[model samples]
Target chain A: MDALTDAELTILGLLVEHPRHGYELEHVIEERGVRNWTALGFSSIYYVLDKLAKRGLIEAIGPRTSAKSRVPFAATEAGREQCAAATREALAEPSPVRARVLVAMANSAALPDDEVAAGLAERRAALRG
Target chain B: MDALTDAELTILGLLVEHPRHGYELEHVIEERGVRNWTALGFSSIYYVLDKLAKRGLIEAIGPRTSAKSRVPFAATEAGREQCAAATREALAEPSPVRARVLVAMANSAALPDDEVAAGLAERRAALRG
Candidate 1:
């Protein structure tokens, strides 16, 4: 099987912390500022949950009592193992150059000087706050 | 529209470096050790290319001569702007917390001590070479 995408790992980590339904997971992601660049959808969350479950890494528990029907999920032994393995790999090496920012950095010189400067300025402002 | 996924950016960056056909692009990705954990398929590349074209970030040129028919791609002005924006954002910040290693570090204690140690040791070995 393919290694879990960063998005999948993020969902797994959140689930490991606590069993949450799709909406709750989505809420936590946004609240934590994890969706700045990639806006993870509820569908993607459920998709990862299903994939994790299929891999024996996670299992669905009883549904949560909420305004909408929600299925909570819990990590299984395999899920914990996968999460651990993923963590180790992620830390041990330079992360996969899959990050858009890193890819962009590789060719930043191709961009206009003014645009690059403005973008950096905006980023600094965002980070400073 | 939502920010392009990292995969989309990677595809764009690759095209910016040189206009390549789908197979050629895929070959470059694998040759570059960019597909260690994530196996990027030909379909995904084409998908991203289409999306980029829709956003005016990329333009598809005439097909290339090869064993199988292939559509070559080139970066448009908007694509350059997007790449520049992405680069600036990536360098100016601490980077997204989306890296699985960071997330795993956040909860590394949950993993078996021996497993963690072994993983780190393996990582150190990999880095030393």
Candidate 2:
């Protein structure tokens, strides 16, 4: 199987910790600022959960306590294995950092020096935020 | 118009320097170690050039000097303007660095502490290379 995407690894890793309903997953993701790191969206929580369920990497466990409470999902053995392997890969392999500014700087001859300097100033200000 | 992709930006940046055919552009990319930074592929050079030509950001200039000499492409006025704007945007914007390791660390509870430590050790060695 292919390596899990950041989103998949994240969701599976969370499920491996403990069974959680979709709402709980969303809450955890928000509390942890997961969105700031990965492109996982609020709407994608259920979608990702469904995908994991269909893949048999995760499965729903236990009955919902109430009609409003969604069924909780837990990682399967396969899911745990996959998540661990992915985590190991993530830890071992550093993804390339593509700095767009590097590319721009390389071709800065495309613009005047003053303009490039101004852009750098703007970038410094943006980064301060 | 949408911002240029990394491939688009890299190729256009090179073309903005001087008109070059596919072969020259390929040579420059290799000499500059551009692939180490961007996802631009050896084969995708022609494809990106074609896209730039179609968008009117770049255009064919002059005839092939020989059967071996490929048609060269150069950035047009519109192309220069766009490249400059994109360069400015690139310089002024700092894309978020999404470190997958951070996510893995956050959910490191998925694995044993020793395993996590081992993975990090492996990562350190990998980064040293």
Candidate 3:
């Protein structure tokens, strides 16, 4: 099987934590600040869940009546294996220093001097914030 | 303009270092270990280049003759600005710990005890390697 995407791994991890319906999963992701890495829209979550389920890595436990009736998902044996493989790969790889900054710095000649300084300043502030 | 994708930014950075044809860009990418984070196939680079050119962030400087003549690229004023913005955003965000491992750990009950231990052992070895 193809390696899971970062989003897929994240969703699997959350499911492993406990069975959760789609909406609840979204809440946990937001609460945990996963959005800081890549924005996790509702559509993306459902998409990953569907893909995981198809792969036999995750299964729907049952529809539980919450404030609204919702279907919660739990990880499967295959899913556990996939997750373990993904985690090992993620932790093993050196964290990517995203190319965006490097490209900007390399091409600073393209920007007005003031704009370049301002951009850097803004970046520093954002990093601090 | 929307910020450049990671691939686009990598391409722009490479161009900034020195003008190069698409093929050369691909070569540098392979040599530089950038693919560890995400794969950069030939088509992906070309696609990103086209997108970057349309956004006025990158431009085709001129076609040069190698074994075969090819179009070399360069970063433009708008492109530099976009790159900077993307870089800042990337640097600012905390690197995501991709969710695969956590999910596996959480759902270890699904796996045979030996498999779970084996998985962990494999992860530890990969980390070391």
Considering every candidate listed, which one attains the maximal lDDT? Answer: 2
Q: Write the per-residue lDDT of candidate 3 for residues A58-106, one digit (tens) a residue.
A: 9988854543227888999777667766665554344443334554454
User: What ordering of candidates by DockQ runs from best to worst?
Assistant: 1, 2, 3
Worst 10 residues of 2 chain B by lDDT: B62-71
Looking at model 3 chain B, which ten-residue stretch has the lowest summed lDDT?
B94-103
CA lDDT scores, all candidates in order = 0.69, 0.81, 0.66
After superposition, which runs of candidate 1 have C-alpha atoms over 4 Å from their true positions?
A: A27-47, A50-69, A76-81, A88-101, A117-129, B16-18, B30-47, B50-69, B74-94, B97-99, B125-129
Candidate 1 lDDT, A1-129, residue by residue in tens: 777766677778777777887778888877876764333665667777778878888787874454332777888877877877787776666554335445555556666788667766766787788
Estimated TM-score per prediction? 0.66, 0.59, 0.55
Candidate scoring better on TM-score of 2 and 3: 2
Which residue segments of model 3 deviate by more than 4 Å?
A36-42, A59-71, A88-114, A125-129, B1-25, B36-129
Q: Per-candidate DockQ versus the true complex? A: 0.36, 0.35, 0.18
Where does model 1 sit among the CAPRI classes? acceptable
Clash totals for all candidate models = 1, 0, 4
Q: Using DockQ as the measure, name the better of candidate 1 and candidate 3.
A: 1
